[model samples]
Target: MAKITYIEHSGKRHEVEVANGLTVMEGARDNGIPGIEADCGGACACSTCHVYIDPSWVEKLPAKDSMEEDMLDFAWNPDPARSRLTCQIKVTPALDGLVVQLPEKQI
Candidate 1:
């Protein structure tokens, strides 16, 4: 399992262990971490799970696909270089220290 951290805009933090093959959104959702609405339930069909990956981990993650990139256009205050949809990120041992920050609100 990978240990991931979700930092809310208010400065609260939730660090959880996520099993391999599960998405980051699932990690947050299962742990009852707030901020990732995941309205579409990991289907990549919504922007509610938008988050900004820590700068150091940005290059470590897989590049966003066309569908995710397009959906990010509707995310709240997205950062061109750091924003990602939690649902699209799969957890693995390689991402053991992954950290993501939640935006103030979802759109």
Candidate 2:
């Protein structure tokens, strides 16, 4: 399991272990962590699951696909450098200490 830390806009933090092969959004949803709405489940069809990856981990993650980039345009205050749809990020051992920051609201 990879340990992921979710930081809410209000500064609230939730740390949980997510098994490999699941998306980051799944970890948040299963743990009942607020912030990620995941309206489209893990389908990557919406921006409700958008989040800002910690700068230190940004280079460590995979590049965003064109579809993910397009969907982020619909997110609330997306940061091009750090924003990513949780559903697009697969959990892996390399992401054990991954940290993501949630936007103030989902649009």
Candidate 3:
């Protein structure tokens, strides 16, 4: 399992261990991390699961696809360099201690 830290808008954080191969969005949703609405589940259709990876971990993640990139544009608080669709990031041993910061809003 990999440890993931989800920081909310209010500064509250939720940490949980998630199995490898699962997407970050699924991990947050499963662990009941507030702030990640994930309206479209893991289908990558909604930007509701958008998150900003800590700058330290940004280079460690896989590059985003065009679809995911496009969807990110619709996110509530977009951060060009760090913003990403959580559903597109698969957990892995290398990402064992991944930490993502939630935006202030998801609409």
Candidate 4:
């Protein structure tokens, strides 16, 4: 399992242990981390699951696919260098201690 940290817009933090191979969206939702709406249920069809990956961990994640990039366009206050769709991020042992910050809003 990977230990992931989800920081809400209000600075609240939720730390969770996500099984390897599970998406970050699932990790947040399963653990009830606020700010990750996951409206499309990990289908990569919505931007509600958006999160800003900590700069230190950004390069460790897989590059965003075209679909994810497109969806991010609709995210609130998108940050090209940091924004990511949690549904597109698969947890792995290498990603232990991942930190993601939620936007002020999802819609």
Clashes of each: 0, 0, 0, 0
| Candidate 1 per-residue lDDT over residues 1-107, each given as its tens digit | 99999999999999899999999999999999999999999999999999999999999999999999999999999999999999999998999999999999998
Per-residue C-alpha lDDT of model 3 across residues 1-107, encoded as one tens digit per residue: 79999999888989899999899999998998988999998898989998899999999999999999999989997999999999999998888888999999896
Clashing residue pairs in candidate 4 are: none
lDDT for 8 (candidate 4) = 94
State the lDDT of candidate 2 residue by residue for 10-98, as single tens digits. 99999999999999999999999998999998788999999999999999999999999999999999998999999999999999999
lDDT for 19 in candidate 4 is 98
Give the better candidate number (3 or 4) by TM-score: 4
Better of 1 and 4 by lDDT: 1
The C-alpha TM-scores of every prediction are 0.98, 0.98, 0.97, 0.98
RMSD of every prediction: 0.5, 0.5, 0.7, 0.5
lDDT of 4 by residue, 1-107 (tens): 99999999999888899999899999998998888999999999999999999999999899999999999999999999999999999999998999999999998
* Runs with alpha carbons beyond 4 Å of true place in candidate 3: none
Candidate 1: Cα lDDT at 33 = 96
Instruction: Tell me which of candidates 1 and 3 scores higher on TM-score.
Output: 1
